[model samples]
Each structure stands twice: as structure tokens, then as C-alpha cells.
Target chain A: MDMRRLVGRNFARIRREQGLTQEQVEERSGLSQQYLSGLERGQRNPTVVTLFEVAQALGVTPVDLIQPDNVKMPRKS
Target chain B: MDMRRLVGRNFARIRREQGLTQEQVEERSGLSQQYLSGLERGQRNPTVVTLFEVAQALGVTPVDLIQPDNVKMPRKS
Candidate 1:
């Protein structure tokens, strides 16, 4: 499913919606701007911890960054 | 939130629901059972790629592994 691209796409979309820039997210997430750039570009793969940190920085959940763009899949717990 | 524990909980639940064991997942996901055990025990921090691999092995999406156990948060994309 190309999760790297999916996460990058969602991250860019959500950051824009929140009116946040990469620099702002870098500050909030305690992740380097370079790394954030790589992530947004789908050039870097992040750990679950990194995903959680970025989500918190963006004021969202980890799932928010990884969900499919088309449909909301059903989940149990 | 503690994402490691969340992923672990979700992983175990979904694996059991699918009637698959660690061995089966190892075969399907190409992840070592030792690593999967640590992941299920909340002792390992996995990358997004690993999460996606495990999700695929379980017949679920990456979001399913990281979603909160309580509420199904609303998503835009």
C-alpha cells in the first residue's frame, strides 16, 4: 500500500490544514527539520515512536497520519 | 499516548482474531518471531514499514495497528 507515501501525503495535508510549517512541526515534534523534510517527501521511514511524536505535534493521533486517503477502513478496538 | 503498547495490543488482538500465530505472521510478514514477540510484548519500537508489513500480514491496514483502543477518531482523509 506504499505506507511511506501515504504517511507523507497525510502529513502534508494535515499540517497544511492546521496551518503549520515544517519548521513549526520540527519544533513541536523534537524531530530535525531535515528528517521532517525527508518524511514529508517520503524519503524517510519513521519509527512508531516518531509517528506518535509527529502526531502529537500536529495535535492528532498516529492513525491520522497513516489512514488511506480514499476510505476510512473499519477497525475493531 | 504510549504507541508501543498500543501497537502491541492491537497486533495481538488482530492476530488472534485472524487465528494466526507468531510463526504464521513471521512467514507472512518476513519478520522474525523473536522480533514479533518483542513487539507484542511492547518491548520493541518498530518503524512504519514494519507496522505496515505486520498489518498486511494480518489482513488489515496500517491505521488499524495504531488506532486508539477507545474511540474511533474522526478522519478527514
Candidate 2:
């Protein structure tokens, strides 16, 4: 395993769909807006716990964040 | 928002109950073993994107990660 981009993009998209701002996410998840912003860009490497916090705020599960859409396994370079 | 531990512990407990190891999670999620290890322990602060990857791997949603359990608002210091 090397990289995971789907998660961040999906997360940001979903958040937008839900009409939630980074500030609200921060207020709900106790995470800073700056960090949340970074997460959306896929620039930050989050821990499982933090993932849980963000997930809880969004009303989903950790599994949802990591599930592959097409189920295509990419080869490591 | 100051602290959010429920998410991390809940995630870890669920993963453990599901019989998953950090290596297995890494293998499934395109994440590193060390990073996965840190995530399980809630030591890592994951970005939203990483959160998505982890949730996807677990077969859940991001909402599941950030949604507060009791719906109780903690007083911010």
C-alpha cells in the first residue's frame, strides 16, 4: 500500500453535498478547520482516532471512508 | 471542540472485533503498516482524505466516523 486518494476526494465531495463547512466540521469533530482543510486536499495523514472523530461528525463509519468504489486493486509502483 | 476520543476507541474496538490487523488494513487500504498501526492506536491525526480510505476499507461511511455517539455537546474550555 502506498497511497490513497479516493478517500479525501470522496470525503470532501460528501461534505459539500451535506452543506457542511470546514468550520462546522471542526466544531462538530473538535478538529481544527485548518486540519480539516488539509484533509480535504489529501495533504494530511490522519490517524484512525481522528478519522473516527471526523466520521462521527459526518454520521458514517470508518469502513465507509476506506471502501474502494470499483474494487480495482492498483499495482504498487 | 476540544477532544474527541470516542471515534478512535470505537474504531479500534470495531477493527479488533472484526479481527483485523494493521498490516491487513494496510494491505486492503493502500496505507503503510506504521501509519495504520498509529491510526489504530489513535495516535495519528488523519486527514479527511485518509479518513475516507480507512472508512472505505472498513466498509462504512465518513459520517459513521465523525458522528458523535450521545449527541451531547461538550463545553469547550
Best by TM-score: 1
* Per-model RMSD to reference: 6.1, 11.1
| DockQ for candidate 1, C-alpha atoms | 0.69
Tens digit of per-residue lDDT, candidate 2, span B2-35: 2235556656766676688777878889999887
DockQ of each: 0.69, 0.17
Cα misplacement distance, residue A63 of candidate 2 (Å): 1.3
> Model 2: how far is B27 from its true place, Å?
13
User: Tens-digit lDDT track for model 2 on A1-77?
Assistant: 32245557656877887899989989999989998887788776675566567778887665555554566779899
Model 1 regions lying over 4 Å from their true place: A72-77, B72-77
Q: Lowest-lDDT window of 10 residues in candidate 2 chain B?
A: B1-10
Total clashes for model 1: 0
TM-score of each: 0.89, 0.48
